[model samples]
Target: MAEASANIGVNFPPFLNSSSPTFLPSRTLKPEFPLTSKLKPNTWRTKPLNLTAFAPSSRLTSAAFTQTDDGKFQPRIEADNSRTGRVFFLDVNPLCYQGSKPSLRNFGRWVSIFFEEVSHSDPVIAVFDGEGGSEHRRLLLPSYKAHRIKFTRPPSSKRFTKGNFRTSYQVIRDALRSCNVPVVRVEGHEADDVIATLVEQVLQRGVRVVVASPDKDFKQLISEDIQLVMPLPELNRWSFYTLRHYLAQYNCDPCSDLSLRCIMGDEVDGVPGIQHVAPGFGRKTALKLLKKHGSLENLLSAAAIRTVGKPYAQDALTKYAEYLRTNYKVLALRRDVDVQFQDEWLVERDRRNDSTILSKFVENNDRNLLVQPSKQV
Candidate 1:
């Protein structure tokens, strides 16, 4: 295990003060064990396995739930002073879609940047989009992600044919395998769902995760234990989107983000918003409704009881209840995907082989891949 310095701190809100045992301090504390120990053999249990090898220590703590004045018991997560393990989840689909011309070499450059600048010695798991990745979503709504195929299609260039895409993907996979990074692709499941399930699984072991992708759909997954790092091609860097950034931008909790998106449809995915289905329901209206009601379900319930302030908003909800529900189903990421975490996935990187692969992809002018500070979303 890497010795955590006292200076290293996690990004958590300062105002939350709790003395509960479940409250972990928002700082990196010293770990009692080393990072090189082998984990116990897996029994293929139904429940979450005790991944002590990945945790800071053997003891596991669950977030404490407290009853608020409103009679709701909400989970309270205070930063524990204990050391927290970190992992990076790289989404390969977005990386392939980046820039005007997608080059096989860019895959190597991106992975190299992550290890050299973002992850350092931390473990990374590269997730690729499985075959028929969007099939399940499209089954729910045939229009789901219908517009993305044309946008993601490789341009008519001799260097970027459909065959070349497959070749590039295989080369990148081989390179990552040689460097000891686990490349994951589940049959008929998108990388987003796989990453989501993996994030949930890893969080149970008290490990923090950084999801590397530019997709806004990942915003709903941001929390104290998880964050999204978006790529910025113009600046040649990556930026983080944390829980703090999400709250600042939406003026609501990250949990409500899905509901907000339900009301304001994703143009890229071809999902129609309530504004299109029911006029006068734009982003501002959706935000205001979400801030007051907290979620699409609650807003719909309020509308049913005729308690929602505006008559038009209530009518819109009542009329488009099924549509909104379908939207939620389409947008909500599945966390129940059957994906197991492997101890071997946390193995150390082969720096020599990694450097060799990176050198093959690097141009002479491309140097100094420093991590830039996160910009406001």
Candidate 2:
């Protein structure tokens, strides 16, 4: 549809031709909230990004390259005084609350610790998806995230009402501002896009980044110098994610995460998909089809080939081709999303107890707190 996989010339058996029996998906799990809006198919207007390279700085502290017990790389926090500085692109939603369902008011202390744990002495640019975050995606597919807006967040305790999550979010924001951590909320974009756009900005300066969020969508941004930190409320810890770790867990390269999501669709996002395929079946089927044909275009092309027996992938690749293409446009990330890259955004400011950075941010009237002693600060 919108994008094709690199492997398009896959060899197919001679038996494949136009007269084959097309397979059809038999069932799809009923959505919690049924789609009310009509699904319209259209090519996206936003331009796709042609990313040249993502080579972040090679400089590091002695412990920057530490590995887990399994020998996978772990992102390390660095000293501002270190040769290479580190900044955390902390997704504000995680610090928002555990679920739309209500939770405790412990968001402040927990977020402070989380910022400290991930950013160390380095600065954290907290990002929040504005209230209309999914607006553009809805333009792509009317059904995009139709299920989420209807549900009310449940408060964990009586003291914290379901409606108080926003209040909690504000409390966390003030707490962060007081801590000298600069936070951003682009009025009409999702936090993920803001994070992506900002990641490109920092990577351009050869600075390493740690995206602190549990959202799996950020996996597409992983690389040698960029890593993901997931909040683990159950264990009261955080899980680190890397490209190597993603491959080890999903059996496919991290680059294919978007493609896989396009084929199967995501219930969380309310993206429509093939019916009859069981929950988790989409991933297995998509992985198989991708492995065999290399890309979605090829997989769809191969679906057109006539086979002696019925093919199970008929509906999604053949009949549903238009749907897949439309979803890809919505699923793909836009790195060129016209966000202003402020110079101070790339500067990692310190958050010492003296409130020096906080005072600097307010006094300078710069959303991005300047960190340098001799110049800006």
Candidate 3:
């Protein structure tokens, strides 16, 4: 069930089309101030200008986003003590339905809603799943989420339609863009994978990364600095989870562990954990049993096993082993994704730190309804 490629072609804003007249060629100077005596041959270094060169007002060019730190940049708010946080939101599964629906517009509304709620707090970067993405994972592993696709009734006249799905996706993208949010999408990878890659990159830069998606699968990425934020309609009602708590609650540990998928396979991905076993139950069993016998390989090798559950270990050996093997692959999240950021992705502008700096932008952009709230949520 691959997504149609045409849908992946979400339009992005064009690059700066015309350079300004201020971008002029620097005139060669006859060493008005003697060049450094040990200057390397052929190297033309700009003499340190006066205090004006160091002033915040002098470096107002938009190019600062890409050029600061010599092109290696990460997004940051203005120079302030405020913590830098990157929020990633994902457009999840689509329920196919009939007839034309305004999806893009709806998503735009949601994006507007999201921005209106949190735009004042931190810098946000968003990404969308391209076509043929999450669905492709199933093709790679037959049981990736086999359980969810089970057909309920006999063949009928009705068929799946993607009309509303497409509209919803575009709505989010456009809304985000209308508010100047950076939305990214890459073909052939699910939004989860892209989010993982982005999270990994920024975590190394001492920034707190929060993924704003409802997918439980992203639990695998939870860590000290990398947390999961499930926001609610009531701003203060959001839920935050850490990796340690996740591991303890879920009965599965990603650290120093194998791909056993916590023992129980995920039915959502067609993984059959311990054959007839259920989702959370199978996982709990695998984690507990492995704790006693060591690895799945060792658990199978043991002549006798202890358990508090049904169907003794030996009787379910092959089933459990296979479940562990298959589910591990299914549970594995791809942490490597090629998201090339231009140098501009970093380097905070003076205006970014002040909500007032964006006032003019909000007034001019109809899509942007997020006014700096008179008070914080």
Candidate 4:
């Protein structure tokens, strides 16, 4: 599951995109700005940027949800404030939740564990997939993410009723809103594009950002001010996938990984790979090929060599070189897409100092909202 939880503070307007940068944050001159920055860098040659570990050391106070007129569960702001230099670009997808039809209580727990890892001063802006997830991508490839809409196994009768599944996701969104986190969406864009836009936009203001999704597409967005955070909900641990993490894990850079993706294709997104041609055209072989020939363009240009490993489809790759070009567009994240931002969305909410009451947010908020309606008769 590649999708999951993440959002920020903002008073959203009726209109989405802004003509002028009304929400742009103030910037300060920094001495450490990378000079060799390019739109697309040769990632294989570049060294990894030094980034702060994703784990938060200080013990953060947990509080029960304080509801206002609208029934949303927000943390009762009560913790000593400390500065977190990064603003989190959180993605709100259910891929992180376990089992069939995950409940709102599980969502609340996700928020709790995730928030506890960052300082209260670090702002978060959670983005959700809009009406049709990635319409543009679908126009490119009709099968993009179409497979994710339906679960492989039937929904659990004990877990959630027929209609309750959608509601559970809604409750998660409502709970995040209750916390005053800006849960945003553009009419035609998915969270991936919105996150890509924000990651680049914030970096221009010199603020650091960390994207909280395990989607491989985000790997290309990794830079000095931006990183990726992968949550291991099962083990109750979160790992920061920086440039170093990727290099150590994949033996290649994110840009090179993108090139590899074009060759391998993603079954999750419904993109077909050239696996029919080259039996060994998986990750390792692709990386090996990428290393031998600096870029995909170079690889395709040179003579097709017999690759090592299972079912070598050397001729298959030669025949499908053109198809690889078409898949690249589908596999790559659109860094040039349009997205709107709210001013307050960029700033972190100061953690309040009034600490007294303590209760589990899920137990209190979800018992009625989730249980009474979905309980088996």
The lDDT of each candidate is 0.61, 0.53, 0.42, 0.53
Query: TM-score of every model?
Result: 0.73, 0.62, 0.52, 0.64
Query: If both were scored by TM-score, which would come out higher, candidate 1 or candidate 2?
Result: 1
User: Mind giving the per-residue lDDT tens digits that candidate 1 earns over 1-377?
Assistant: 11111111122111121122221222222233433433222211233322111112222222233335754434454444342456678898667543533444565667777666566545678887776778878888888866553113333465445553444445556666666677888777888998999887777755567888888998887665676777777766666665545545655556678898888888778788888867877788787787667778988988887767577777899989999999999999888776777655544344456677667655521431211112111
Error of 1 at 131 (Å): 0.3
Q: Which candidate is the best by lDDT?
A: 1
Q: Residue-wise lDDT of candidate 2 within 16-44, one digit each (tens)? A: 00111221111112222322222111211
Off by over 4 Å in 1: 1-34, 38-83, 150-166, 361-377
**What is the per-residue lDDT of model 3 for residues 1-377, given as tens digits with 9 covering 90 to 100?**
22211111111110010122121111223332332312222222345532111111211222222224443322223442222323334433321111122122223333344444432223456666665555656655755543332112222223323332233344444534444455677777777787777766765543455666556677666544455655343443334454434444544433314434445555545555564654334555666665455455566656234433456545576445555555565566777777753223332111232233234333433332221112100
Judge candidate 3 against the unseen true structure and give its global Cα lDDT, from 0 to 1: 0.42
Q: Which residue segments of model 4 deviate by more than 4 Å?
A: 1-84, 100-102, 150-170, 280-282, 301-314, 352-361, 364-377
Worst 10 residues of 1 by lDDT: 1-10
Worst lDDT run of 10 residues, candidate 2, spans 7-16
**Whole-model lDDT, model 1:** 0.61
Residue 37, candidate 1: C-alpha displacement in angstroms: 2.4
